[model samples]
Target: MSDTISLVVAGGGTAGHISPMLAIADAVKDEIPGAEITAIGSPGGLETKLVPEAGYRLELIPKAPMPRSINLDLFKFPLRFIKAVNGAKRVLKESNAQALLGVGGYVCTPAYIAAKKLGVPIFVHEANSKAGMANKVGAKTAVAVGTTFANTGLPGEEQVGMPMRSNVAQMDRAALREEARAFFGVSDQNPLLLVTGGSSGAQSINTAVAQSLGLLADAGVNVVHITGRGKQIMDASGQLLAHERYHQVEYVDRMEYAYAAADLMICRSGAGTVCELEVAGTPSVLVPLPIGNGEQKLNARELVAAGGAVLVDDKAFTKDYIAGHVAPLLADQHKLEEMSRAAAALGRRDAAQNMARKIIAEISSRSTSGQEG
Candidate 1:
């Protein structure tokens, strides 16, 4: 009601963070049609390219990666952090941001402090089951804390699910099944497996798949493999591998097609992927990243618990595991369909719109109170 809603979306270094941030932007824009959204990201982070590509203005701040151990970088941390906060403050003032929506990351810490300094309402969404350090700090005084998982233990936690792309969230795989399969050159009678290692690709996963290609093909499973950029599986001759049943691409621009066409998936279990699988109702074999704070493992917990996915450690996901576990699962059409139903039940298709309504409601409440006062 007070002109147009202005928001600062903070967080992005990877697709995990940027995707949900964009989802929030898309939902808010859908509601207000002319809402102003400015994204704050670190200069070298993936957001530099993605935010601008999505038609949102990108504001870069100095990277403020937290040092785990005392090192030369630790000495430089404080000064860099202060500068990042000051830069965030400048963006907030310039945009006159009424509310700041942050999906947790290194970038959000400064943005959170900056938004609080200016008395702008701060809303945070934590996508992992284990909250990141940045989000824990912001949630201390956030207007509200929305979470994709129930047990993050953050203050004021609300299980609002993930803010996912509308195409994924609203996908009716059953309706699109025929078209999607045809688009991927997969037949309805044959099992289809979608394999990906995310944007940068996971070497471990790629190697495992490289070894399992012959086995998968023998089982009559068609594969659409996304090898990340420059991670394509190649033959002994240094050319891309050739297989009649295998289609390999560096990346997928429209993932909805991949999701709809795939009966099962083998991929990393980042929070974003877990949620998308749930939305698509595609059962998967999830290999949680071997690093970080074990958040990836935690992110896949509920889905695994619900029988939607099978969890394997990065090291244990070898060619033997693929032959003994994955190939058999793909052959079991009944079990795959059952897992798909369980996964679908866990997806909250309205997360973006739900979070959107909360942010807009917060803005309206402030305006109403100001007028009444």
Candidate 2:
């Protein structure tokens, strides 16, 4: 292997895609000093901000979302897709990328095509139990395929687990619990419930939790509810109430602390959030978003089956349901501890390192083959 290696990572749209991409990038850097990593994302997607913020050079290409129905956009798809592929080829050529690692999103399709055309090795990671369309296409010719869950149905897919941020991967929840609870203005002795619906928030979860705040507080559970940006929580008079034990915030900048303070989580189960909860060993009641091809439901299935978490339909995630199911769970310390142990047992703490090692080995193998040829 050379002193420096160059790789192009393609994935974006939401944090689910971008976070894992960055985790792998960070791991690659830690393993190989002076490695050049460039990110490819859609022009106006969330990756534009997050990729640069993570200190990686981001290159943009036009987004060519697969049209679901017969529409005018479907006719224009070929031109837009070709443009994205050419743009990706330019980035790969200019950067001299040895291999392309795709975490799976709209941006990755063109990147995969470009790598294939250029004879560059391609590796892919699928974060969901059911593979996304882009990953399914990429996997057909990918040199290796990695999945967060077992039995993803992709050919030769290996269960490497989801790569997580370094802080989360190395977090000692017990050691940081006291400080984390104090940071959120909660008592260290009280069991904490962390409620979130990812960055955009879920209306069902917000309404249910807001209405049941009194019940949860009465149960001696401290609540840290991240209501997502621009989402509102109000009393009957339409005023936001801030109780001593029920803390409401629009967003939390440092999720590590939230994970540290939480004894249990009540939230929508995106792939990233599910993996984060398991890795952090926080028991959860997952309310999967009831849209988007049922991906969230699939993401939470294994965790629920493992007894590390519970699954409830979004329609049933009401105030009454929380009072009946969640309030009792909060009271049972023995059950919570058991769930926590199960979650920790299933978590792969070294996922980022393992994925990075696989990627590097693929690159080394390609290099050797090229030299011999």
Output the number of the lDDT-best candidate: 1
lDDT of 1 at 144: 88
Task: List residue ranges in candidate 2 displaced over 4 A.
Answer: 236-238, 371-373
TM-score of 1: 0.97
lDDT of 2 by residue, 206-239 (tens): 9899888888888888899999998968777889
Q: Model 1: which ten-residue window has the lowest total lDDT?
A: 180-189
What is the TM-score of each predicted model, taking all chains together? Answer: 0.97, 0.97
Clashes of 2: 0
lDDT of 2: 0.90
Minimal lDDT window, size 10, model 2: 235-244
Q: Model 1, range 102-216, lDDT digits (tens) per residue?
A: 9988999999999989999999999889998899989999988999999899999999999998888999988988888888777656889899988888999998988888999
Q: Kindly report which residue stretches of model 1 are placed more than 4 angstroms away from their true locations once superposed.
A: none
